[model samples]
Target chain A: MSFLGGVDTSNGVVLDPECSLIGESVRGRILCFPFGIGSTVGSYAMYQLKLNKVAPRAIINRSAEAIVATGAIMSEIPMVDNVDTSLIKSGDRVVVDAANGTVEIRDVTERHVVTSILRNRGRVLILKRSDKVGSYRGSWAGVSGFVEKDEGDEEAARREIVEETRFTNARLSRRVPARGFRHNDSVWTVHPFLFDVSSRDVSIDWEHEAYAWILPGELKDYTTVPGLGAVMNDLLSRTSP
Target chain B: MHLTKDEEHVLAGEEGAARQKAMELLVSLGDIYGAERLIPVKSAQVSGASFKTIGDAGIQWLEDMSEGTRASVPSMVNPLGLDMRRWRSMGVSPDFHGKQARIVAAYRSMGLLPVYSCTPYLAGYRPRRGQHLAWAESSATVFANSYIGARTNREGGPSALASAIIGKSPEYGLHLDENRLPKVEVNLPSVPEGLVPLAGYTAGKVAGNRIPLISGQAFAEDEHKSFGAAMAATGAVSMYVSKGTVGHVRSRGIDRSMIEERVTISSRDLRRCAEELSGDDEWDLVAIGCPHSSTRELAHMARKLKNRRPRRNCDVWFCTSRMVHSRCPQHIATLRRFGKVLCDTCMVVAPIEEMYARTATNSGKAMVYLPTLGRQTASFRTTDQLLEAISR
Candidate 1:
């Protein structure tokens, strides 16, 4: 978001055609966006909004650029960035801890789940989640399960691999950065791990009805769980040193 | 980013909120750019001074900042939207001057020098070779980094202000020696007479964001000024390494392997740039001085127009800094006969769209900005050509 020519300072209304919140007012509400663009004078336009008593109560950005950060500081508005702005919906009750650099979205629950890919001779294992599963039933995924509060993420990943696929000899290869996916009121933070196995002999568990060993390129053809394809590519792109 | 105990205290808000805020901005920028630590700066030249650019929002922000803080270092400001003394004569309205006055006052109260020109290097307070600075004016930043061997990234208005209050800037980008090495080589093998700005203009287009090693021709000081100004305007780059003009920087052993891209700007290309940017012959105003005229430029223009008579075909403004204006009284007087010798402002930052729809200038930088920012159908001309067009 930009303030100069991108927003109306007098009424606290967004005028930028490129913005998602066009025609909506930023007054007295928390503003969440990816980042700012346009002139440096946009910084002062933000201050103008503050003087008009119509500035955002707080601001959140996926990444803070100089323009918005300067404006936020000058307006004395609380700001926190380095956030997943896509998870935040308009009208969502959001709390920003600018000092601590944390954001809390009210009514949004978070779930931590681990998913592991078992590779044998370059072919990867993808399981079809059974209807009995609570979420994303019938979606294709890797050996996955919830991460227990007492368990470390990697420990949970190894445990899920053994229990769900019945593979004990799979050696841990690599782990990619965790990603969050929003569904309903829940934010599923998925931890992805890759493991190398000696055999393609894995027994199916109760959580999945079917399993298939397919090329990494074919993962996109199947209806998979959210961000599974992305995590799979990330996991497979690098070899463990 | 590594901060000293006092810097940490400022960031932690142990200092006043204003200083803390300034520190926060500096530290945040430092973190963003991956600076190891903050480095003390010699001075700061801040942009976003013009009321036509900043408007009411800028005024209020400066006022708010002024109440709690003052410049910790020697800081100079960019141009205002109007000349304080001659606004009415320049056809500026009372309402515009009133707002412009507030902006000047806000900056003044914050202990900023009311230099009100982009050419702070020319108006004194020139940064020495190897000295660090935080300057917001793109043209001056280029001049400082390339011509003077001063280290600085092209800072934004608020960032430069933060540096002014903190007396420090985050060491990154052009502030570092490695980043100053030219990635692209721009060879202006042969430039035509009166086409230095266009040479820079074409070179900027070819160079893009990379630093260009400008070679194949030597440039005078004033020639370098207009060249660097146009380059910074058309390109994302703020610094250029002119072959021989880099002074002490030539000793840094610039690796030939670093020049990954080599582009030769032909004399034909510069002529094309001029022809294209020239647009329509009819113009509402003919304005000069984008980086603000140096004393030499004012004297040269005065000499050319001294023997001629005003054509009175259209309005003409020879824009320069008050410092430069004060230095050459006879030149100012002679130029004033042909047109207004506007001080403290240039065509790029002024509210020219309100009174003029079509404009003509000798500045290649103005050709880049006037169409979009000033809302004018901009035309390009050589300084001699413009002088001849305005006077007989």
Candidate 2:
């Protein structure tokens, strides 16, 4: 069993007001919480970041936020979900390979790929990755996993969805393969999938302490799983309900 | 791709620096927008005409780019300021003066009208949604697209002029019909009561960039203008929310009767709006003039204070076009008795937090309430609400 890292879900994530400035400062690629905090104007800041051509290429989060997701979509920034957030800090050398839904955490030396996507509607999702197994463990994540030895990428993707969302019939839309690229020291691929669900349909799994459909712009209220914000931002951008 | 005889002549350098640069700029801009040829402008608005925030280099670049197309049509403008005199008072330099003069000279040659206010729509230059126009107001873009269904991109000053002189803009981004569709669905708890700035503030923060098709319990047409203003102010974004009748409003569900009630200017509504907005919070700044308040609005302010003394600690400002500023220098003494009246300026281009700690506004438009102006914590309300907040 492989687990990545852990994130604090005791209180909701509180987003930084200057997050937009941070997002705009990164010229090429950056990793952050999937969703932004509650402020619809934050959505505009994201778009402005894109309009000014100053947004990151991709993002990594433990959960995905709808507002950030919408911004990423409108701005056309690539993103991925499900990373071991406890293991990463604000300025850590982490690579979000949105092409493979895996985050390559490279701090000084050791590097590994963790798969996940930040999602929001009813509540943000956070999962604990198993560090002993692979990359993340005891770390809170959104949705994450790796391909099974025999299962195809799409089948593995579906299985991961079931494991994360607890919905056997997620009704996967289109499965896009490797929508991004490899990170600093790892080779991984991502399969972007859109699952149809509303704020009322989601239920929590033990892997996460709690779940609630956070308002779109206020994803920053939750602080534990910062990675979830980045993932939510990316998925929201790519997936349209 | 297809240049007119005059355009060809300008392209061939028959025009002087102002004319040549104008033509070259237009052609380059046209190529970017995929415009087949230059079209005539109904009007245009210039940015950095007085070098408010940008550098002299930006002004010089505009001059160099707009070289040859001086034979352009009549147009409107956003102000550089009343005269070069205000420039030094505002800490503007001589280099800035040279660039501005060059632009002013070019605009004079092209016969561009220098009204110098962002609220051209307020000054009788409303471009119906989807109409090809060269407007330069960012809030105006949000107002036109979200409230009026017009299409434009807050591309920049030069592009706006080019579009006006050529009477065409690049047909991409918001200009495309298909792109205007709402991406998010918002359902509000209730239409905000008078001075509930958060209602419009929430809407703007929630749907800054996307086309938001919202049906809120509290949303009334009167508040739409505040929402639109907030949306435009927060970010470089626009919105599309519905108002029952007027399309946009300064209050909640203000019916025709209320407008009739307000038609006779008693300054009562203004006082009411201000009262409703009175409250204490850690504010970033207090912003006035969502569309650059009209002279009549300023006159009302003067009239209101005819009997009262000026209040201290509050940095109140009245924004207006350059033309309006020039037309009423005498009015300045009256207004100064109450507060500062900044001409050829709006909060849209000027810094909000730079002057105050938080912001408050009375417009129902989202463009002004959104993040680029102040954080989500910024307060909002009707003009009446603002008055209340300030008085308390």
> lDDT by residue for model 1 over A1-241, one digit each (tens)?
7889888889999999989899999999999999888778888889889989999999999988888888888888998989999888887889889889999999999999999999999899999999998988999999898999989999998888888888988899888888888888988899999899999998988899999999999987899998898789889886532
Candidate 2 lDDT over residue span B1-392, tens digit each: 67879777866767555444445555545554455765544556655454434334344444454554552545676655333445454334566566667767766655677566666766667666446455556666666666665656664555565565556544455656555555555555444345433454454556657655555454433245445555565544664545452223223542232111111212344345445444445544455666676666666555655555654445555667655566667666766654556766555444333344455555544233334433433455555444444442
> Which runs of model 2 end up more than 4 angstroms from their true locations?
A1-241, B1-41, B46-52, B71-73, B79-110, B185-198, B214-225, B239-241, B244-287, B299-303, B312-315, B322-334, B347-392
Q: Tens digit of lDDT per residue, candidate 1, span B303-347?
A: 898889999999999898888888999999999898999989889
Which ranges in model 1 have alpha carbons more than 4 Å from their true place? A120-123, A127-132, A159-168, A198-222, A238-241, B1-17, B247-252
Model 1 docking tier (incorrect/acceptable/medium/high): medium
**Per-model TM-score on C-alpha atoms:** 0.91, 0.49
Worst 10 residues of 1 chain A by lDDT: A232-241
DockQ of 1: 0.60
For model 2, how does the per-residue alpha-carbon lDDT over A1-241 read when each residue is reduced to its tens digit? 0000011112212233444333123556574653444432233345445545556667665565434543444345776655544445555666666557777666533322234343434344444544453543455554556676767766776677676667665554443334323334443454455454433454545545444445545656545333445445555565642
Minimum summed lDDT over a 10-residue window in model 2 chain B is located at B257-266
Could you tell me the TM-score of candidate 1? Answer: 0.91
